[model samples]
Target: MSEATDYSRETENLDNCDVEAAYARWAPIYDLTFTAVFRPGRRALTAAANKADGPILDVGVGTGLELPMFEPHTEVYGVDLSEHMLRRAAQRVERERLSHVVGLYKMDASRMAFPDAAFACVCAPFVLTVVPEPEAMLDELARVVRPGGEIILVNHVSRKDDPLAALDTWLDRHVAPKLGWRPQFPWSIIGDWIDQRSDMELMERRLLAPFGLFTMSRIRRLPLSQDVDAPVMPAELEYA
Candidate 1:
C-alpha cells in the first residue's frame, strides 16, 4: 500500500475503536503497563482532589482508579463509556467494601447524563488527552457543576519548555495517532479552555512527578454581567 493509503487505513481503524472496544482490548494488560506510567498523574490528581468537596463525579472514571483517593465522608460516582472498565471499577468498589460510598454508571463524558449542579466537584485523571473532542467534554463538565464547585484534572501533557515545542507537536501528530489518541490538539492547552470562559477560576497549579500537571479550578457559570467582579488570568493560570 502507498504511504497515504497506509495512513488512511490506520486512521479508519482507530476511529472504529470506541472507548469500550479500545479499553476492552487493553483490559488485561492495562493495569500492568499503565500503572507505573500513570503514577505521576495519580499523585498530582490526588493532591488536587483533596481540595474538592463531597459528592464528587469522576467523569471517565476508568477502572475505579481514583477510588482510594476519595475521602471517607464523600460520596463518589464513577462514569465511563466502557462497560468492561465499569465492571472492573465495580469489582474494585466491592472489594474495598465501598458499595455504600460509591456508585457506578456506564455513560459518555462528552454528553453527561447528570443534572445541572448535580455534583460538588468533577474530576478526570489522564482522560482528557484521550478524549476525541475535549472541548465538548469541557462544556459538559462546565454545565453540570455547581457554582464555586471544583474541576480537578491531572494529565500527562507535552512539555511546554521543549525548545520550539517540536517534540510535543510531533508526538501529538504521530505517536498519539498510533495509540488511537487523536493528536490534532496538544494536551497542554486544556487550561486555556477552562479559563477562557467566565464561569471557571483557576485556583491551583502543581507539577506531578515524572512530568504530569494538575490543575484545580472553580466553576461559576453565570454570565459576565452577573459576575462583573470576577478575576481573569492568562492561559498559564498566572495572575498578578
Candidate 2:
C-alpha cells in the first residue's frame, strides 16, 4: 500500500477503536502507570480551578482525573466521551462520598450538548491533542461557558523550530496504526487562533519544562465588542 493509504488506514482503525474501550483497558493501571507522569501538569489545572469564579465543567474528564481539585465546592460536573471512563469517574465520586458535590455524564467534547452559558468554568486537559477536531471542541467549550467564566486547558504541542514535530508526525504515521487515531497537538495552533477570536480573551499562558515543553493556558470570555488586543495580566510560566 502507498504511504498515504497506509497512514489513512491506520488512523481509521484507531478512530474505529472506541476511546472508552481503550481506556477501559488502561483504567486498571491508570493511576499507577499514566497518571503519575501527569501530576505536574494536573497541578497547574488545580490552580486555575481554584481561581475560577463559577461552576466548573470538566470536558473529557476521564476517570475523574481532575476531580479532586474542585474541593469544598458546591458541585462540579464532569463529561467524557467514554461510558467506561464515566463509570470509573462515578466510582471515584462514590468512593470519595462526593455524591452531593460531583456529577458525571457521558458526552463528546467536539460537540458539547450543553446550552450556551451553561457553565461557569470549563476544562479540557490533554483533550485538544486527542480529539480529531480541536477547534470544534474549543468552539463548543466557548459556547457552553458563562460570560466572564474561565476555560482552563492543559495540552501538549509542537515547539517552533524544535524538530519534535517530526516525531509526532512519525507517530501519526506509524505508532497509531492498529490504534485507529492520529497523533495531534492542539496547542501549537491554539495561541494564534484564540488571539483572533473576539469571543474569548487570553488571560494567561504557562510554558512547562524539559525543552520549552508542555503548556497550560487559561482563557476567559471577553466583554461583547471589547478589542481583542488590550493590555492584559502577565501570564505565568511553569516548568515541569
Candidate 3:
C-alpha cells in the first residue's frame, strides 16, 4: 500500500484510505455491477439537470455512468475522489464523444477547488454517507450551488424503525469500513441541516423504485426572491 493507502486504520468514520482501496478494487467491475442497478436514480438526477439552465456538477461521479445521459447541449463537470474510477469515465467520454462533458477532475467532495456559487446545480448520487462528514459535504454542495439554483442528492436514508437495523449494523462493522460508506445513514443528517439553515430548503423528497430502498432529495438555495428551478419528475411521471 502507498503511504495514503496505509492510513486506513487512522480514522473511524473517515476511512478515506479504505475508500481509496475499496474503489480501486471496484473500479474495474463497478459499471458492470452497478450501472443497471443505479440507472433509474441517475435518470432522475440528469433529467432534472436537463431542465435547468447553465452548468451542472456531478460529485462522486464514479466512472461517470451518468455522463452520457446528459443532453448534448447541457454542460457538465464531474469530480470524484478516485482516479481509478475516473479513468473509466475519461475513456467513456472519449469513446462516446461526450463533447458536453466539459471536465472530469480528481477532487474531494468535502473540500472542492471551485469558487463559491460556481454552478447552477450540483448533484450527488449515493455519496453523502460515503464521506467522513456528510454534513460538511452537504455544506460544500450548498456553497457551490448558485442562490436560485439547487443541490440534488440520491442516497439511502435509514428508516427510524428500520427492520434491517441489525443487518445495517453488521454492514457498518464489517463491510462499510472497507467500502468507506454508511449504509444505515439517517434522514436527520440531511433534514436537521436544512432546518437550521435559512438559505436552504428541501424542495422534494421522493422514494425510488426497485423496493423503494433509495431516495432523491432536491434542495433549493434561497435568493430572497427568484424563480425556483424545475423539479425532478417522479418515477410515476416518467412511466406515465
Best by TM-score: 3
Better of 2 and 3 by TM-score: 3
Per-residue lDDT over 60-156 for candidate 1, one digit per residue giving the tens place of the 0 to 100 score: 7777666776767777777776666677777777778765345677666777668888877788877776777788788888777777677776665
What TM-score would every model get versus the actual structure?
0.75, 0.79, 0.86
Off by over 4 Å in 2: 1-18, 161-166, 177-188, 209-212, 225-240
Model 3, 128-211: lDDT tens digits are 988888889999998999988989999888875666778887898878867667888889999999987878888999888655
Better candidate number, 1 or 2, judged by TM-score:
2
Candidate 2 clashing pairs?
Answer: 13-180, 14-179, 14-180, 14-181, 15-180, 209-240
RMSD of each: 10.3, 10.9, 9.6
Candidate 1 has a TM-score of 0.75
Supply the global lDDT for candidate 2: 0.68
Poorest lDDT segment (10 consecutive residues) of candidate 3 = 1-10
Off by over 4 Å in 1: 1-16, 162-171, 175-178, 182-188, 212-226, 229-240
In angstroms, give how far residue 222 of model 1 lies from its true place: 7.7
Most lDDT-accurate candidate? 3
| lDDT score for residue 85 of model 3 | 82
